[model samples]
Target: MTNLLLALIYLAFISLGLPDSLLGSAWPEIYPGFGVPVSYAGIISMIISLGTITSSLLSDRIISRLGTGKVTAISGLLTALAILGFALAPNFWVLCACAIPYGLGAGSVDVALNNYVALHFKSTHMNWLHCSWGIGATIGPYVMGIALSGGGSWQSGYWYVSCIQLSITAILFLSLPLWRRQEPEDYGANTEESPGSDASSAHPRPLKLSQVVWIKGVKEVMTCFFCYSVMEQTTGVWGGTYLKLFKGMDAAAAAAFAGMLFLGVTLGRAASGFLSIRYSDQQLIRLGMILTAGGVLLLLMPGPAIVTVCGLMTIGLGCSPMYPAMIHATPQIFGREHSRAIIGVQMASFNVGMFVMPPLFGLIAQHLSVGFLPVYLALSLGIFALMQRRLASLYV
Candidate 1:
């Protein structure tokens, strides 16, 4: 039963990731079809980020009321519907509207599941479950590529993924019994509390954001979170555009290559799960920081197209362990009572980064060239390193 429940959660995480890469992969075709400026992708991305922000901040209350089972199921259904809306839309405005529910669903499911799994599952399960997310993320671009190939419609891509989403939603709805069967455990243990637990009220009642912001080390950690998110989301959202416009790939090829980062991520997290047995969370994070720098340097160099593609994969590989390790470390950094709330705030900071930077880069791509992406990523990575340094100092 435990293994079955964990498998279900992994599936849920996969659902969380399926739609994430679609727009970025399809955007070159989408923008041309919709007759919008290339920068308009930012508008849609920003709207999605805004919705995620709202839902992420409100996740605790919603999860408290709905339980993890219902919240996951309902959010899955919402995302499925939103993806279908994207498939059927006639105008860019409808795409923009569809972005709303997708964002809201994605954010709440992310927060709820991450927190739930962190407490109930093994430490390594958290890492591997995220790998499951990478799997879905990797598949998205391939699906879009298939849809765009042979003169097929991008709508078909979203349509297929929406069908997958509906399937996952049904599984989640069926697993409500599993979620209900687990009891809440004492989340305060230094180790994962127990296998049989749910995330309901996992943290003590959340503190106000004003208060959470003032906790020792919170500022630095939040800065790290924000910078990390900016790099990751910006890359996911704009990586294909960079490939298409600057690297001379056609829409189909660029869309397919966009999955390279996610593929690297999927592999990296799988490796990290095993590495965690021998290394501390901070140790894994530090290694990631170094790798990310090397990856960014690779991007900045004048190179063959393959070199640039390799650079994207390297960046994705470097990023894999950082997020889950950071979340796993929260209870130790702050008290367990405060960890859940602080993690929520961290995610909010992450959402804020997602909200602002992608569109900001859209303006950059609009006025300047997407050629500036490497430099932009380099700067973001440098800032992330600095904050992680500060966070480490305060951590011990």
Candidate 2:
């Protein structure tokens, strides 16, 4: 029963990832089809991010009423329908409308799933949990790449993903019975071998953000979350278009190559799952920082197409472990009692970065050179590394 339940959670995580990379992969084609400039993708994305922020804010009330099972099941359906709308929409305005529900669905499910995992899994499971998301992220663009490459429309690519999301939603509905842990505050109700499943906050109070700000390492960690999210989200949303505009690749090839970043994420997290057994989260995080920095430098260097592909993948590898490691270490850094509140604060920072920075970059792309993206990535990554070190100086 437990293994089956874990499998269900893993599937939910995968569904969480499927929609995330679609826009970046499809945008090269979508903008022209809508008779809009490439920078307009950020507008749709900002709308989606706003919806996600709204959902995250309201999730406690909604999830308390519906329970995690129902929230996940319904959010699954909502995201599926929203993606289908993306497939069927006639114009950019309709796509903007669809982003609302898609963002809401994604935000709610993300909150529910991560809360459940923190309450019922180990760090290694957390690593693999995100790895499952990596798999879906990788597949989404690959599916989009295939659709575009095969002389099919981007709509066809969305259609394929919508079908997959719908199938997952059905399974999520079917597996609702196994979530006996959902109704209770039994944060310790995980498998016996994995002791100390967290009592993370599902119902948080209005945080006195000013108070936690004084905690020695708090600001640095939050800064890390902010920078890291900006890097990952910006790359996922803009990387393919960067390839097309600068490298002169066709939309199809750029879409496929874009998946390599996520492919590296998927593969890196798979390895992180094993590495977690022997290494502390801080150590793993440091190692990831090195890899990510190296990857960004590779992007800066002029190279052949393969080097560009490998650079993206290397950045992905660097990204893969840091998020899960940071998340998994929350209890240790702040203590389990304070962990939830701080994590909530950290996520708020993450939300702000995701919502603002990517679109800011779009403005830059519109006003300046899209070719500056690699330089931008390198700068963001350097800041991220500095924050990690500062965080370590205080806590790790």
Query: Which candidate number maximizes TM-score?
Result: 1
Give a tens-digit lDDT track for model 2, residues 1-396: 668878888998988888888998899899998999987987888888788777765665566668778989999999999999999999999999999999888777776666556555666888999999877887888899999999999999999999999999999999887765544543433445333545464344434557666777888888988888877778876878877887677898997798788778888999999998898888888888888888777766775666777878888899888988888777566654455446555666688898888878988898997788887887887888888877775443
Q: Model-by-model lDDT, in order?
A: 0.81, 0.79
Model 1, 1-396: lDDT tens per residue?
667877888999888888987887888889988899998987888888888888877776777677677888999999999999999999999999999999898877787787777556555877898898878877888888888885789999999899989998998998898887662443533333443323443546757778888998898888888888877778877888888888777898887787677677788899999998788788999988887777777777776777778888998888888888887777667755566567777888898988888878988999989999888888888888887777786553
**Candidate 1 wrongly placed segments (more than 4 Å):** 27-38, 145-152, 186-203, 236-259, 302-306, 361-375, 393-396
Q: Please list the residue runs of candidate 2 whose C-alpha ends up more than 4 Å from where it truly belongs after superposition.
A: 25-38, 142-157, 182-185, 188-190, 193-218, 236-258, 302-309, 335-345, 361-375, 393-396
Best by lDDT: 1
The lowest-lDDT stretch of 10 consecutive residues in candidate 1 is 189-198
Clashing pairs for predicted structure model 1, backbone only: none
> What lDDT score goes with residue 301 in model 2?
72
* lDDT of the structure predicted as candidate 1: 0.81
